[model samples]
Target: MEESDALRAARAVRRSVLGDAYVDGQSADPDPAGREFQDYITSTAWGVWARGGALASRDRSLLVLAMTAALGRMEEFRVHAGSALRAGVTDEEIDELLFQIAAYCGVPAGVAARRVVRAVRAERGEA
Candidate 1:
């Protein structure tokens, strides 16, 4: 099937944020359930919403990390934390955001997010 406009746009934006290797890894041989989910989130969450705003990708990346962290979505927090780093949101910025998260979202959530951020940073050899 030909790619939909949304899918194409999503592919571009997703690549820009997550990088080619990660996106390609997720796109490989997805199960039916996974395919459906990938399609929907790519088309809607990324293609539509992530691309719709005036905020730069860097800003969006930071917001995504913070929101995922506050919700204790560890997998998503890790993914977006990596993306935020790639998008040029510094470790210092993320550290400061963790403090904000602790103030409102609770210390446990901030701690959990910090763990993910650390792992991601380690994976990328960023300290």
Candidate 2:
């Protein structure tokens, strides 16, 4: 696809990933600390993720969700878990990722991630 078309596709997929919270997260009133740094991270992440190389989108997104969940950041993992699905990661893959992380991130963290995965799947009408 053309770059514009690719970007449009990415944006649509991004929107599905973020769900109803997209409006709240995007074009928002800036964060008090600074939105620029967040923008930088966002840009870097997107470029790395959408590069058409590196990791496959589904795997990249799944890794992100797993890493975030391992950190025990429920909300962020919740966001990324949904994003992973939109990136074409399957529910089975997500479940396995969380389960594998249990060995290192702990059972509690894995359980928490599973909860978010379930909720996300339900929201997407896939559960």
Candidate 3:
């Protein structure tokens, strides 16, 4: 399939933030619908939010994590939190972010965010 400019840019940004292994894994799913959904995100979420504007990838990643936590979206939180690390956010910063969420967005949300953060940290051998 021919890749659009947006898809190309998004893929670059996504890989930079999530690593080539994770990005390739996303593309490895054999289902057409899954591939299509990934493509759509490449053209939208990563293409626009991740690749555009003045916000550095690290800052954008942190913001995305905070937003996902505030909205109680654990799955998205997991993805972005992992990506945040790849995007150069440190564990301490993530901790601060979750603490901020607990203070403002509520304890449950912060707790949920912590679970995902720990899982990702463990995956990276930071446990």
Residue-level lDDT of model 3, residues 42-79, one tens digit each, is: 87888765456788878888888988899999998998
**For model 1, what is the error of residue 85's alpha carbon versus the real structure, in angstroms, after optimal superposition?**
2.3
Best of the two (2, 3) by TM-score: 3
Better of 1 and 2 by lDDT: 1
Best by the lDDT measure: 3
TM-score of 3: 0.87
Across residues 17-118, which tens digit of lDDT does each residue of candidate 1 receive? 889998888877558777777777788768754456688777877788878877889899888888886677888999999898888889999899888888
Q: Write the per-residue lDDT of candidate 2 for residues 1-127, one digit (tens) a residue.
A: 1235545444544555555476346636466445554344444555456556666778778778878887888998887876775678877887778778887889998888888888988897875
Candidate 2 stretches greater than 4 Å from native? 1-24, 30-38
What is the Å distance of residue 121 in model 2 from its true position? Answer: 2.4
User: How many clashes does each candidate structure show, in the order listed?
Assistant: 0, 0, 0
